[model samples]
Target: MTDLELTELVKEISLADFGKAFKHQAMFNRRLRTTGGRYMLQSHHIEINPASYKEFGTDELVGIIKHELCHYHLHIEGRGYLHRDRDFRELLEQTGSPRFCSLVQSKARTKPVKRYIYACIDCRCEYARKIRMNTARYRCGKCNGKLRLKSE
Candidate 1:
């Protein structure tokens, strides 16, 4: 859906769930990579990740909207709006909103990781690691032998 639809949805959820009117803007932000949505404390605007709605559908979108609205309403009223705050936690439970949204599959890392292989020159003991280690500074644990790069 478009930004206008998103704003309308946020307003509706705010009114229905919290009994508060959302005066700030709500829009889909494509640049949001890890989070479902974020409430801007400065502007009182809510920015939602488009991938959340596209991947998880309207149910997930509503959850994200509700989560953001919790922050919006609490902060506007000068109460505790942070996640660790009591007021925020109570509002979340009262509205039946999720503490966190579902993960977006597209943003998850799927690339195969490269492994670094190292072997001892004397004992032929091999070690596999995610990061490359210096052969000159490090020795094999088996026999204290010199280590060499076997393969990447």
Candidate 2:
């Protein structure tokens, strides 16, 4: 969705869930990485990770907005606003906001499935394996040495 849509969604969530108006600006930040959204203390503005929408769709966007709203409302009320605060936790529960921002990764962005990479303990020869092999049972084909984990 566009930045305007995200802004509107944030406002809607703030009012509907918190019964408080969000007076600050909300915008999409393409540079944001890993984090779903961030609440700026200085400006009281909320910046949402655009990657979140691209990866997890509108539902995820709503959840992130709700989470930021919790921070926004609590901070404005002079209550505990950090994630570790009891008031913040309670407000999150009450407002049905997600406690943590989950990683939103696109399936299309993933590389072809490659499970394991077995390497020779002695020569360091790597072998890509689709299935897990018993290290004790299987030896490296190159030098007949024990294999070690090179990849997950």
Candidate 3:
């Protein structure tokens, strides 16, 4: 659906579920790969993943809208809007909103594999890092010793 349609749907859901008006923008965000929707704190805008409707259909879309609405309403009224907040959780349960958006596994959760290892020449202390560094400019904090690059 288009952004205008999404905005209307959000407004409809907000009034129906929360009995509050959604006076903000709702748009289809193609870049939102990890979550179905997100409510922006700064702009109070709701971004819905269009792919979610294609993949999960209207029911999931409604749920996402409700979830974002929870955040939207609470944040606007100076109440706790974060997922961990008691007010947010209560709103979720009262509105039957999902705790999280579906199919939102972020690739950023996994730490990158370390590629470079450095060790102090005198203290034998080791440091693992993801990127290579200029050893000439830095030294070990444990001792004022020269550092050497060690192969993994």
lDDT of 2: 0.86
lDDT of 2 at 82: 97
Candidate 1 per-residue lDDT over residues 33-75, each given as its tens digit: 9899999999999999999999999999999999999999999
- As a TM-score, model 2 comes out at 0.68
Total backbone collisions for each predicted model: 0, 0, 0
The C-alpha RMSD of each candidate to the native structure, in angstroms, is: 2.4, 7.2, 3.5
TM-score of each: 0.85, 0.68, 0.69
lDDT (CA) for every model shown? 0.93, 0.86, 0.90
Off by over 4 Å in 1: 110-112, 120-133, 139-145
Residue pairs whose backbone atoms clash in candidate 2: none
lDDT of 2 by residue, 73-140 (tens): 99999999999999999998998889877686652245567699999999999998778888998898
Candidate 1 TM-score, C-alpha based: 0.85
**Cα-based RMSD of candidate 2:** 7.2
The total number of steric clashes, by the backbone 3 Å criterion, in model 1 comes to 0
